[model samples]
Target: MDDLSKMGIDAARLPGWLRFVVVIVIVALAAGASLAAYRWYARPVTLSIAVGSLDGDAPRIVSALASRLAVNNAPVRLKLVETGGPIESAAAFSSGKTDLAVVRGDVGDLSQAQAIVVLTEAVALLVAPPGSAISDIAGL
Candidate 1:
């Protein structure tokens, strides 16, 4: 204590009320820093998504997903970017304008893209009367 006072940095010399206030200030600063760190860690990550469709189904689906994520307080959120169609969406994704995109498998350049989900599938079927001459696709 004597050495600290000689160095002009003695805590023991502080008045009782002043020392209490100093301790309170230090604790408050520590608590504020902890809160700031927690907020930064808990913040959600937002990703931009490019979507396009002639019938508007792609945009609608993506919007619904974004809304659901927000409502569920998900850690990852989406921001929808509506392009004209699959080609435009693919272009946006390929050009690095968006982080994710909804595009058809056969549309545009997809060499750098990987399919995450199959949204739709198509199958062909033909029906004819039992006595009909149509037995194959060429018979029609």
Candidate 2:
């Protein structure tokens, strides 16, 4: 006990079999922790995606895709960002505020943007009341 105290080890009061069992349990715990660490490093990557609103469809679509990626344990996961409109979303993407963004081609300067996925084509429509004689919006 004096010799053990000199060496700074405190296992003197433990029985042989109890010490062996303790050592085995410690080894098992270490192995389990190592396994967990490996699993965490081996899991999928996460990415951020920005989408706009006021059309309201883009954010929902991106969110659904993110959910699907998580459900399948995909190699990549998307984090969605919601900006108010297409121009704001494009600005966010161009300014390096986000990793990915859904922006309209004509909305803002897209020199910094690249193609990832092209979803659909959309057209803007304007409606006028009947017998109003409003041929053009600028003339109204």
Candidate 3:
């Protein structure tokens, strides 16, 4: 054909190496395109977690939780959703929009969701101001 002649690729005269190169290039391009498509579709899924109170140390605690979760190599991505209060956080967890949430042990009934892990035990410390006679448990 006139088009073939213009390209100077005399189909019959083209060496085997040239043909091989062309095939390799086409295969490489196809592989690259497939990889790009896979990456786009297999993007990580974000799992929202309701965190009680965005103020004060709450945000820091949430950040630490997220980091720990990441280190565990969980498949889903973690997103901290601040509910501004512990009550709201508990509600969010019960409602199902949030996958996980943090709340005080006595906050509410948690029979609906099973505990995956107990991170730590929360301790209550009683502090006395100034020169108080409170030295031990019986110093009231």
Best by lDDT: 1
Clashing pairs in model 3, backbone N/Cα/C closer than 3 A = none
Candidate 1 collision pairs: none
* Model 3: number of backbone collisions: 0
Global lDDT of each candidate: 0.92, 0.86, 0.79
Using Cα atoms with residue i matched to residue i, what is each candidate's TM-score against the true structure? 0.86, 0.63, 0.53
What ranking emerges by TM-score with the best candidate at the front?
A: 1, 2, 3
Q: State the lDDT of candidate 1 residue by residue for 4-72, as single tens digits.
A: 787898676689999899899999999999999999999999999999999998899999999999999
lDDT score at residue 114, model 3, on the 0-100 scale: 70
- What does each candidate score in C-alpha RMSD? 2.7, 7.8, 7.6
Per-residue lDDT tens digits for candidate 2, residues 50-84, read 78878698899899999999999898999898898
Number of backbone-clashing residue pairs for each candidate, in the order shown:
0, 0, 0
lDDT score, candidate 1, position 70: 100
Worst lDDT 10-window in candidate 2? 5-14
